[model samples]
Target: MKNTLLICLFVFAALSCKAQNIIPVEDFFDYQNEIPDGTYIKDINNVLNKFTGTWLGSYDNKNYEIVVEEVVYQSQIRTSLTYDQLHLRYKITDANGTILLNTLPLPDDNDYVAMGQYVNPSGAYQLDYAGYEYDCGQSGTLFIKTFNDNTQMKLYLYLGESPYNEDDCPNGFAEQEFPTNSQMLLTKQ
Candidate 1:
């Protein structure tokens, strides 16, 4: 009789407590429930974020320092914006500490920048922009390869411009040869 009475009293107390305040159980399988309010998720893209920063390297007896500045991705869809475009400006000085190449853009030049970005998930970002020459001819392409957790980078420039000496040769150039063919290995500074 005492055991039955005790069981009945325990059941009554549990029912009364549940009736006082109730808490809804979250569904464990729901994806949205896992993320709490006032938090966000970043879209991890294999593009500009990894490659943008100051990098140091050397090529042709010159020490090079380049900055991969991120530019806004202007798209029709507002939600799809990211640091997709990049301005790969650099400052290359000779071993003697004399400046050889410094094309680093000023901060105010955001209206019209140098380079645009194309994605390469496997290795690098294919950048299409005007050649780094005042009068080479026209536009060109830059292949910026990155590795080692964005600590290392390699830049290969393939300029698509014609020779000014059209009269001297009288024949077209056999292959695509740039006046300034360059390859650089750089590390993030």
Candidate 2:
């Protein structure tokens, strides 16, 4: 009888722990739909405006430039939080006046706006770029941070170890035995 009682208590404790760990259904779909309401809302514009104008950088012995503008995005998906998220729109170009990047991934999409700083105070105002693809898996994340005071900007691109799922890798898309230029450094133009 004592053994059965102990087993019952153990089962109850296990079930209680499981119930505590079960997250709510909505918590699983925690997507960044829009900027959350906060006390620092007023300062967001000034921070965003700092990204405007032209910034230059280089990759693969070639030159590139980024242009930022504050504009009104068309209001679509009326009920969605991202329907009219106000922020800086970026345009990237090369020396020969070739469009280098867009919002979506493309052959020439070397740079584009990824997202905005949601929490502001200690959040990252990040961007994504096709940091110079040697093979299929050639994407990287560019972090924008305060370079020389609040006026200037510094852009750093970090290429993770994971390459594309291309058939180039003999053993399931692994990195080759060559030096991969995994980091890019740039300053505001």
Candidate 3:
């Protein structure tokens, strides 16, 4: 009797470990109910591959250099769900070649690094952006859309007015960091 019980318990444990459900990244939000624990929103189709790599662009005499990389993350707060996501880093410099803001060298887990949220219905990827100047409220959503066979891309940054007052700004009115509303063309390198 003891030997039979042990074998049954082992089989059940093995089955439970394989019970995780894998869903395509695009269809993740379509689920009706709250996603169960241990569900994976995977990029099984490699839809995010085209956006990975370095991209460069310029606007208003400032050069923008961005890097996008994909990563797999497991969420402890969201019931241990695992998913694929993108992380972005950027460097902006003035026409005179003066460095303005650079998050390129920061560690991957840095708060200032823009983290990809999801792919929009228009196929553009949206990222949550928060610059180091957040005290002055330099934060917003950034969208990236690829074109010309993924060789070229467009970046649109939509930002809101600062919630902080002048007194909160040690720099005395934070200069807008990125181009707002207008889409800037970027080339993949």
- Per-prediction TM-score, please? 0.56, 0.43, 0.83
Stretches > 4 Å off in candidate 3: 1-20, 160-163, 170-173
Our model 3 lands, by Cα RMSD against the true structure, at 3.5
Model 1: weakest 10-residue lDDT segment is 21-30
List all candidate RMSDs to the true structure. Answer: 14.7, 14.5, 3.5
Least accurate 10 contiguous residues by lDDT in model 3: 26-35
Best by TM-score: 3
Model 3 TM-score is: 0.83
Q: Candidate 1 on 2-89: residue-level lDDT in tens?
A: 9999999999998886543321111112332343332222223434677889988876677877788766543343443333366777
Clashing pairs in 3: none
- Candidate scoring better on TM-score of 2 and 3: 3
Reference-based TM-score, model 1 = 0.56
Measured by TM-score, how close is model 2 to the native structure? 0.43
TM-score rank order: 3, 1, 2
**Residues 104-181 of candidate 2: C-alpha lDDT, one tens digit per residue:** 233221233433322233333444344334345544455555545545655554554445654664444433211244
Ranking by lDDT: 3, 1, 2
